[model samples]
Target: MASAGMRRRVEAIPGRPLPYGILGGCTEVIDVEDEHELLGVEWMALGCCPVEVWNDPCVGADESPGAPAKKQFCRPTIEHADPITVYAGAECGTMGWSYAEARQHAEASLDLGQQEAVELGFWTNHLAATATDLTPAEGPVDIAQGVAALEGCLAEQYGGVGVLHVPAGAAALLGCCNVVQRDPGGGPPTTLAGNCAVIGAGYSTANTGPGGIPADPGTAWLYITGPVVVRRGPAMTVPDRPGPSINYRTNTQRVLVERTYVVATTCTVCAVAVTTCPS
Candidate 1:
């Protein structure tokens, strides 16, 4: 027999609804340290500046059997200032390649992609004479000699906000900034785990960033951006138990904001304003 009481209760229940910011996105700067440009061209500090990078979407587990499998690694979804990525590190591959070669390869990649090099951090390096005020020589050069020459050119060119990437072997050449060397020798061409930043001999630090140095303290983690936000609100809270609770104080919140990102672009590109791309 049908129960009228049960039917009344069911009818009294409210309709279900969805929420926002669940899959939200932020258009921030370049995620990683790739294709980044120094504000005025002299990247001599451990300072952190806005960089332009790329972000690749993950493939669904069952959607594309032919596509590359997604990593078991954790991903974020929140709207970030640099959604593409950030790090003292990204992923370091095993082989070591020359800085010049790498730069050329990166440039080739742009050409292959038909990319217009607006004003990315991508640049050509020269070991000029050493001086705060530098004038880059266009003659034949050696990394050591080129570095000395670079310093002179840097005085007027370097804003001290970007990372001065040198030949993997020439990092020690520049002498204006405070630096505790990481990779003493030009080891293998390695990359960071999260941000894909190439460090060690390839990068010589003269400055630091708002988040301190870019070096990672963990063996597995090169550098972490921000894992500082923890939700405590009752509405967004969940119990501490029950393995996979989404409504309670559970543990899978990486889904709530993990995969999302923010892409912050340069405020101005060569005085024209990169913000012109969009708001």
Candidate 2:
């Protein structure tokens, strides 16, 4: 997405939700603690057809008229929906930047939090596919096969292949075999392995579970498809209260970034876990 990142400037309209329809939800606010925000929240409940079908080839439509009264009542279930939720990041603060320099410094500080949020979302929503289970041994080839297996599992859930969000270390291994490809048009980088498209991102290796896997020594590929809902609130900057001008106090400016999102695979199942043992 480098080309898009460089050439296109996309910004959400302030005070409104930015809907990235890659996931299967909309208008769902997951991080709200208020009881009123939780009221009436619901998800689709798939129903079955009550009428039985005649399997006999000789049965004519008139002779095998199924129950005319049979009906399928499919509705949204109003309950506590388990949308894969990600909590808001802690408020980051910086002190002593001049008034003119505050905004730039604050923006730079926000980078780490934003990366953490991405990592958290990936960790929360991914489905793990490790080397021991998918392949005979650990290596780039095994990880590639793992990617294939993970994509299959993902397709079974959502009936289509998902993209591979790859870590840098894994990408290096996959790249050795020419499995990873750069976007010729300068878009976001992606790798095409088997039926899945892989993307190398900073968030892929965050919190690799109990093994404490880091990006380079281990292999982890997050395969995601189906509906993924990401809701991002705009970043706001303001003067720290007990203001510098109000009191002869420390000159500090605060940048508040509020982001709450549910990175989940709705009923269709969005993500699958794929991993490899340390290299």
Candidate 3:
């Protein structure tokens, strides 16, 4: 028999460590996918407005001042937001978990939201492999040849600065080009012939056409005179608040957390799609 004080001390002694038989885990989470970036021509945020309209300006030979200015009528170009919502959530038993785990979940949810925006930007602008039609290229693309093809189209259309969005496979070929390679000795960086910027996109893919028909993967290379514009509409308004918000729910004594936002993508006429290339 133990004394009263001794019994209290024994009782206070901690039992098995928390989570019983579970082992400790590393704090770091490995990310296998390439992070998405805003690679297109441009980005703009329009709050509350559902549509934007602009008048197309003419660019060509100017008419003689005295010759009665030609009745120049410009067409209005309109861009509308196609709102999309993306969200992520997690639930854990109302008990044991460190704040570290909660932080990880929050970070992952944010990443998913941004990734959705990137994919929308990439697919919004539809382009054809050739000037003739919407058909994509049939096979692997020769980087040099492919670039040249794109240059021709750019010159024919809107010819200022251009950007190329290439998938992993196309990027590999582009990487082998002299333009992308750095000089062994200190020298000026080689420039792509047309003063174009090449961006490698991890999210590039062979998008499906109407009725689920697979389009060409090579069409992944998008040529644009400007940046892809990602617009944020009225933040998904929650009932209680006037802006985007995260809500919580309780189920089976567990808490579920979720967040959401509304976003859209727009492309200008300056963007051209190049589908014929190696996957």
Highest TM-score model number: 2
lDDT (10s digit) by residue, model 2, range 123-163: 44443322212323343335556555655655554453335
Off by over 4 Å in 3: 1-76, 98-100, 120-140, 179-202, 205-225, 232-279
lDDT of 3 by residue, 64-181 (tens): 4344334344344444433334444443443453334444454455444444333433334242221222223564245565556655654455444434434344444555555344
Q: Give the total clashing residue pairs for model 1.
A: 56
Model 3: how far residue 73 lies from native, Å = 5.5
Of the candidates numbered 1 and 2, which has the greater TM-score value?
A: 2
Q: Output the number of the lDDT-best candidate.
A: 2
Per-residue lDDT tens digits of candidate 1, residues 34-57?
Answer: 333221222122212323343344
Q: Rank the candidates by TM-score, best first.
A: 2, 3, 1
What's the TM-score of each model vs. the native? 0.20, 0.51, 0.46
Winner by TM-score between candidate 3 and candidate 2: 2
Over the full model, what C-alpha lDDT does candidate 1 score relative to the true structure?
0.22
